[model samples]
Target: MRKLANRPGGPKGAAIIRRGWGKVLGGLTLSPLMAVLLTPPAAAQSADISQKVKAECAACHTETGNSIALPFPKLAGLAPDYLAKQLRDFVSGARKNEIMFPIASQLSRADITALADYFSRQKRTPAMVTKPQLLAAGEIVFHQGNKENGVPACAGCHTRNGAGAPRFPMLAAQNPDYVVQQLQNFRSGARTNDFGKLMRTTVSRLTDDEIQAVAQYIASVPPPAGR
Candidate 1:
């Protein structure tokens, strides 16, 4: 937020970054929230599952899945449904992050569910505020969804309310810088775990204006109920 120029995961305009796609789509699972209501022994099973995930992922993901540094996304309070979908996507080759592929690959359905459940319940720190001008631009893109460019509204998937379903994350309140980085990743194929291949195609067409507008808009909005 403090004009992080040239910093790691710094502002790189709207270019894409490519990474592995096929290796990310093997370990798929449903969200804990859903599993809990659906499964008979969800509570006890989920507790054990969450513990296992922490032990495995905490080394790099840090406590509560919130990284202290830049570039790494703050996983605390992410939407469980979104997280579960991503883990599945990474395994299924729909999404492709170099770091995420291997980690996701090792996860079992239970592990993915537990991780999503844990992180989705944590709180998201605020996105650093910078480039108000850019954020203003990002707003238009988010609400409008760039029909001319064939991009759908982000709210459609993440939900306008920001109470994302079991696997779609609540983008509201996330770091604009992080969002920008992800968009660039999606555009360039760096982070492809985007649902339905929509983000990849949509992000690819996003201009500097669109990126700034969408990211800012998402950051400006407050998380919805249950987020």
Candidate 2:
């Protein structure tokens, strides 16, 4: 009913009201889907990122998030939430990585989020196939399980294209050596971070050759668009 702009101290009151509104908006949280769709993408958030953290990450994984060395797994085009969880797991000792544990422990919640969001947006390059001969065998094992042994298809969880969801990791175009090592870790019970021991169970009965073949095929798979 009152026109504040026309009254004494109206301008200051309006400025205060505007600041209050900004705080309210800043405090509001976005839903998962909305956050992805509405937030300024990782590239645009560079100004707010910690240069020290980013540099450390780029030292192992290239600035683009692809690690050509094949020792550190590629991070490009992975789910941000998935990446965040891995970082947290490293800090919690759920995923025991001597190198990662200290680095992750130093990260604040904001740092973890920024790192995940940044890496997830980086473009991922397709991996090179080391064993061309095994592609066919690998394809079969990836798309269809060994029914006799009750092995479930890798695609059933990682998706047909291996653009994994928030819980599952992106397997397509990942380093074959890295994949093999992770599978072996799962099999040996060295890695227990997988929910419900799903990965351990899945790869438990798979032969070493089968694991290698699948990793090879997965390495060769070009990630689908918009992963």
Q: Write the per-residue lDDT of candidate 1 for residues 1-227, one digit (tens) a residue.
A: 64564344655421212122223323446586755565677667766766765666676657666555546666778767777888888888877767778888988897888788888787765555566666666666776677887877777777765556564667777767777788888888877665578778878778877886787777677755545
Q: In order, what is each prediction's RMSD in angstroms?
A: 22.9, 8.2
* Number of backbone collisions per candidate: 28, 0
The whole-model lDDT of each prediction reads 0.70, 0.86
Query: Residue by residue across 42-69, what tens digits does model 2's lDDT show?
Result: 6435644647445567788887789887
Which ten residues in a row are the worst by lDDT in model 2?
Answer: 43-52
Off by over 4 Å in 1: 1-54, 59-61
Q: What RMSD does model 1 have?
A: 22.9
Best by lDDT: 2
lDDT of 1 at 93: 81
